[model samples]
Target: MLQFLHICNLALLDEVSLDFEAGFTAVTGETGAGKSVLLGALSMLAGNRVDKTIIRGGAEECIVEASLHVAGNKQLAELLDELELPPCEDGVLILRRSLHRKRGGKVQINGALATVTALQQLGEEWIDFHGPGEPQKLFHEKNQLALLDIFAKNSTALEAYQADFDQWRGLWREMENLRTAERLSPEEAEFLQSQINAINEVDPSDESIEQLERDFKRLDNARELGQLSEQAGEGAREAAQAASRVLRAARELAEIDPEADALAGRLDALIIEAEDLSSEYEALASGGDFDPSEAESIAQRMQTWLQIRRKYGPTTEAVRAKRDDLVRKIGSQTNVEGQLIKLEHRAGELEKSLRKQADELRRRRLKGAKDLAAQARELLTKLGFKKADFSIEVETENKLSRHGHSGCRFVFSPNAGQPLMPLNKIASSGETARVMLALKAVLAKADATALLVFDEVDANVGGEIGAAVGRELAALAGDHQVFCVTHLPQVAALARQHFLVEKGQDDSTTTVTICRIDEDKQRRESELARMLGDRDSKSARDHARQLMASV
Candidate 1:
């Protein structure tokens, strides 16, 4: 339940605070006395779009804040938890909205920064505002389906159907895309085949390219290499011969002198090393036959690599990647006939399941629709449409959707002899308001989280009918918090709490002020009476006294 509301710098309301109770609350004043301004402030807190022009003349921003005591509302608590917002420590949820004159604004829930969408979701759970010019929400197909679901208590089943429907829809779209891809024109198919053939002709491999390049370099420089190797071999052979001669002379000298023997041994080692070097040089000089034809082959192979790289990528690895991708696409194209068969079978199965679930849902909704019509008719009779008839038109389709195959349209007839027609087409704004109110009252038990706000529900209604509207609102207040803005004395008199919105001027500024009215105060009753009739008339006072006494 809403506990308090504080507003500042909104329209003519400079500053005001209203304390509310858990039952029916009424705001009453003369026309243009700022009652609607209060509702506008509440609307802001409820996350409605803000018009910056509502800012007061000297104020740069308008602020609207509300405190709701929701200790018993587990659903709201769960929502707060889901959003990761700090819960009301003392069971008080504080919502504040600030709108600037420059079309900027901020929203806060329980002192935590929140998005407008989040605020709106929370507000929908907490309030429902019915006013003139408010869109006819009941006429919307989605809302009608939601109402039917609520009546049938089929949330779980509807959720299951919706989940499956989403999956089936996704798969259907994928199948369509695959079919389109598989239906490529012959020219497109030929182009793709040409690309594949080009990639396959080069047949490039990582190490194969590197190894071939190495072999080509060696073959290209074979002549220079062979000449260098011959020169090295000749040098080694000359050194070996000279060392052999020196070693033979040293051995002869070693016989004459013992110290010469060590020199002779070192000479022998040098000759051995020279001989090994000469053998290596000789082997290298004997180069394998260098063929010009081999070089031509290498050049041709390199040309092939260059062509492939130019057409596809800079490297063999990149070309190979493209080849793999095309291979997968070709495989999918080859298997398309089989894939289509599978998709058709799956779609058939899904269609069967959808039909069955839709039929079950339709059964529940049809039953719920009858009950809803009966209830609405009963409430309409209470609101002075004694002979009105209410009905729900369920038109079933052969397709599947999240809301099943049935479309629900509410129809109404205001008089006994009149033909029932679509509610939106037949009911006036005032009549719609009352009908919506009646539906809300009936749905209150199931819609315990929703707060119903009625603006001029008493429009075009008076006397006992007005009193019945008041009684209905009062009754709705028993299960849900009710906020009503009214000009009717009967509705105002039914409020457990009443507020008087009055406009005042001080110096250069005009301000709207709200004050809570004590029901025991006769002056407040007289004021409401004046609003209903004439202020100074004895008859009005007497009638006001009677109204108060009856309440």
Candidate 2:
């Protein structure tokens, strides 16, 4: 769960830090009280793109940082490993993001530098938000399928199907290439053969390409290499000889002097070392003698390789791969009919395999759909949508999807007599918000993110239903840390923690403050009473006190 969130220099918020625990926390404020500013900061932390204009006035950058206690979540840890991010220390995963006004922002995970993409992946795995633009994205088809997959624990099965899908796609591409080649005119076939023959003709027999390259490097720098080797060799030899001669002159004296004798022995060793070096240097200076004929042949062969590389490569291996592909295509063209038949058969077999996997996916989806609909109906009923009918319906197309041969849609109806229609067709934004909230309640256990955020979940809800919505959120808080930005007092009254985000202006500068309400009963009552449309009224206070007491 997210334990800490810190934001600095973002929009109306100059700086704010909040500590959270495993429960539903409600944020309430006036319309322009920077409530959305907090959500915006959270969005950036989730790896969503941000504009530089969001930086607080007079600040050059904005920063959002979070600390999550992800202990025992092997799945999240494994995901971090897959992204090559630093592992949690003592069950803590730290994510920090900094956005600059004049440059692109930077992301860090556990203090090790990371990419926005990495942060986004982590967000996808651990964060489920139902809010203005982002949270509702969960209603999309892909996310719907993923929710079902998560419920079914279908990672391994999905991976197997994806692998088969890739193979089928590859075969289809190859078959198309073959068919295209078969339709090539005689001149086109001749041109392809010519390109292939050009590479095959440059055979450096008895020598690998690497060996040729090494030889060429040596021969190319031979002059400079020889000069340096000879110069150093001669200098060392002359110095050794001169020292030896000097020691020889003292040899006679060495018979009487112990120092002279020792010095002369050192000179003898030095002279031998110098001679060995000179011999080695001589070989370096004059070796690798390339005959004129062999040099010409090598130069021509290199030119051929370079020509092919320039056209088809950034490297030798790439050109080589392309060469092999061209050869296969040419061969297929020669036996066009036979190759076509083989490819068609292979494609048919792959399709059959893909269909088998698709069947299994369809069956699992149907089962999951039934389970989700049952849960959805019960959850909606709790949230005051007693007549709501929800279903996850799996439908098919003639073609296959990357997900499978089928897709699913959320069918919903707020009234009993109305025919069930697609969620987008009949669901209003507020209805969508409530529906999403109910789903979040249903999937709380299946969702591993640990952090669930709902923005304006009471958009279309009234006091009659606000208590029910609050109860569902409170129930979800037991297993996850949930955050809700709401305007309704009934909803805010149930929060484990309540905060007021107030915006003020002084001398043309806007400031946003997030104040944790006092635990004093009077202070809590006052805040709730304000939400009830009175800050100092007997009737409003009584209503606010009652709402707070119910929780």
Candidate 3:
């Protein structure tokens, strides 16, 4: 249940805080006193779209927030947990929405940033609004079926049906996609196959390309490299021979002087270094004799790698990746006929399974619709529509559809002689309200909507009928919080809590204010009398007093 609401800079409400409770709370005031604005605020809380223009003059934004106690709402708690939203700590769930001019708007649940879609899901679980525009919701086929299912307590069965339908839909999409993929055009097939054949011819390894290029370079310049190697080898041999002669002379002198011995040792080191250089030259010269035929083959292979790189990718790894993709794609298209046959058989099996499950679902709905019609008719009779005929038109299709096998239509007739037609075509907004009221009374225990707001449900209703509606709302409030905006004294007098919306203007600014009517008899009676249109009249006060006592 919604425990509190706060509004700021919205419409003509600069700032307002309302304390709400579980039971019938009547909101009444003169025409154009901003009661509807309060309902608008509630609608926003229910995740409806916001209009920034509703912001009050000179205000940058408008804010509306509500605190709900959700400890008892297992469905809501589970939904919150699933969405990874903030849980209702200590049973308190805070929801807030704000509209801004430049930045649009935002919704927050328990102070965590949230999406309006999440709030809409919450609305589905917690709030049900019935008013001027809401009765039309009952005319929708899905809504009609939902009401019947709620009455039947068939949510689990419906959940199973929905899950299977989702699977069937996904399978249907996959099969279609596979069929489309299996039959490629001739040109597409040729292009991909040609790429595959080319890739197969030159299976380049990522590790060998650079080494092959270096080998090709050396082989291609073989004549120059071999000559250079021979010249270096001869130069090292000559240097070693010359250094040995110098070392021999130095050693002979060293016998005569120790200084000569040090010079001989340096010459001996140069001769040893030259000999090592000659061995490296010989190794280099040996590589220069690589086979020309082998070199030509390597050159041809390098050309193929170059061509593959240009056509497929810059790197051998990239070519390999594309090669695998082409193989799979071409193979799938080439073998399409067999794949299609198998897929078609599987799809047929899934459809048959879906139809059988949907048949059971439809059977349950048809049985539940009977009880729903009977109970609605009974409740409407008590609400002053004794001759109204209510029925649920459940039409079961030959096969499963996107939603289900059967479609539900709510048909209604207010008078005995009238033909039963769609509720939207037959019922006025007032009659729609009564019909909704009857439905709510019947499904109260099965429904999980925590809040119900009625705007002008008393429209075109008076005296006895108005009192009946009030009693029904009060009774309905036994399970959920109910708020009714009205001009009738009977309904106003029945409120366990009463609030009056009043329009006032100071200078050029017009504002709407709401205040709770005190429990004192004089104050409550005075407000009821004002609603009666004669605050000071003795008869009006007496009538108000009588209405209060009846409650």
lDDT of 1 by residue, 1-551 (tens): 88888898889877878788888988898888888887788778777787788988889998999998888788888999998888987888999999887766898999999988788778867877788765455767677778878888889988888888887887798789887774556676677777778677656687788887777777777778788888898898899899998887899999999899999999898888888998887787665345668777777777777787887788888999888887777678777878878888888888789888889989999999999889888999999898889888888986777788887888888888999887667557777788878888888777665467888788888999999999999999999889898888988888888888888877987777888875557767777778768878888888887777777
Instruction: Find the 10 residues in a row with the least total lDDT in model 1.
Output: 285-294
Task: Kindly report which residue pairs in candidate 1 clash with one another.
Answer: none
Please rank every candidate by TM-score, starting with the best.
3, 1, 2
lDDT of 1 at 211: 80
Q: What lDDT does each candidate get?
A: 0.82, 0.82, 0.84
TM-score of candidate 2 on Cα atoms, chains taken together? 0.68
| Candidate order by decreasing lDDT | 3, 2, 1
TM-score of 1: 0.78
> lDDT tens string, model 2, 1-551?
88899999989899989987778899999887889887887788788888889998899999999999999989889989998888999999899999998888999999999999888888876677776566554568887788887776777788998998898788778777767653667898799889888877764233566777776787787788889989978987887788778867778778888778887787788888888888888887877556778777777777787787789876767767887898876676677678768878987898898888888888888898899889989989877788889998888878887888878888889888988887666546667778888887777776666788888788877687988888888988987888899989989999999888998888978899997883668877998899889989999999998998888
Whose TM-score is greatest here?
3
Clashing pairs in 3: none
Model 2 lDDT, residue 402, Cα:
80
Top of the candidates by lDDT: 3
User: Which residue runs does candidate 1 get wrong by more than 4 Å?
Assistant: 1-6, 18-23, 44-53, 57-126, 182-205, 216-246, 249-298, 315-317, 445-449, 462-468, 478-480, 488-497, 505-510, 518-551
lDDT of 1 at 20: 83
